[model samples]
Target: MTNITKENFDKAKNFYNFDTLYAPVLPGLKATVMKHQDAITDAFYKELANDEIAAKIVAGRVDQLKATHKVWMEELFNGEYGEAYFNRRYKIGETHVKAKIAPYFVEVITSSLRRSFAQILVAEGAVAVQAALAILDLDAMIIIGAYHEDRMHRMSDVTGMNLNLLETLMSFG
Candidate 1:
């Protein structure tokens, strides 16, 4: 029940160097993403559509998902890494779980995004590469972190095991 706490958010921020001087590059990131959004998303959705399960999951929601994806990408470069931001990102993870989004699809989409951003940045004169990647990593960390914690909680409940015990068992070879 406590997976998405402020403490965890802070820890994730620290892990990702969220307070970097490189943050000034956020505007460049924002500009590049906004400018190239259509192409970026076209490629992203193309990759998603290549996967049968992901395509089916998003069968009737391509436009809706595209809109949400743009919003998510915009928020990535907003340079407002606060607890509320963490809450929003974590809520996304929770939503993915509820939508039955597999971790493979999560990885696929994130990889697609990273590659798209990186390529666009390189093409657009490579602004704030470190800062851009750092923020992206932070966003991914929060989302995946919440997704994992939520999955853990559900598993713990179904198996009647404490989270610690479930985690211990998961660590076994």
Candidate 2:
């Protein structure tokens, strides 16, 4: 047990080693997604298109929106989670807002992402993929949190309205 714990810890630590230690481990994340992007996308689109709420929201925007979504998915597997990547993410969020997509779609996207990750993890292997996904999930959560916070703050400033009031109304959520 001690040895197993140590091994997992060591493996987790390599994610931030700033070396190639975690690079090869990422092939599973990329390879599986690359091989099954179509299936994943199909599943995603099916969910979105069939969704009574989101379908009405995403309608008419699907054709143009797919290209942006495709790039975002590819960028994730490409390990390009840099500053520009973050900017693009926020931009897409804003685009969704402009397109009248409900905030609920964010939850849907998160759920879909989790399912896709699980499929990739199982297809690749459990042990290594689990460790790598741990790091990836943590890092992604941190970055996404920061990005969303900044985006909301910016929106608050631009609209000159307090979003906190709206948030308070949705506190039950």
Best by TM-score: 1
What RMSD does model 2 have?
A: 9.4
lDDT tens digits, residues 1-173, model 1? Answer: 46444566677667756666545568656886789888887788888889888889889899999999889878878878776787898888778878888767777677777777777777555546667677777677676777778878999889899997877787694
Model 2 accuracy (lDDT, Cα):
0.57
For residue 39, give model 1's deviation from the true position in Å: 0.9
- TM-score for model 2? 0.61
Q: What is the lDDT of residue 149 in candidate 2?
A: 49
Q: Model 2 off-target regions past 4 Å?
A: 1-24, 127-173
Q: Write the per-residue lDDT of candidate 2 for residues 109-142, one digit (tens) a residue.
A: 6667666767667756765455445444533443
Q: How close is every model to the real structure, measured as TM-score?
A: 0.84, 0.61
Worst 10 residues of 2 by lDDT: 1-10
Clashes per model (N, Cα, C within 3 A): 0, 0
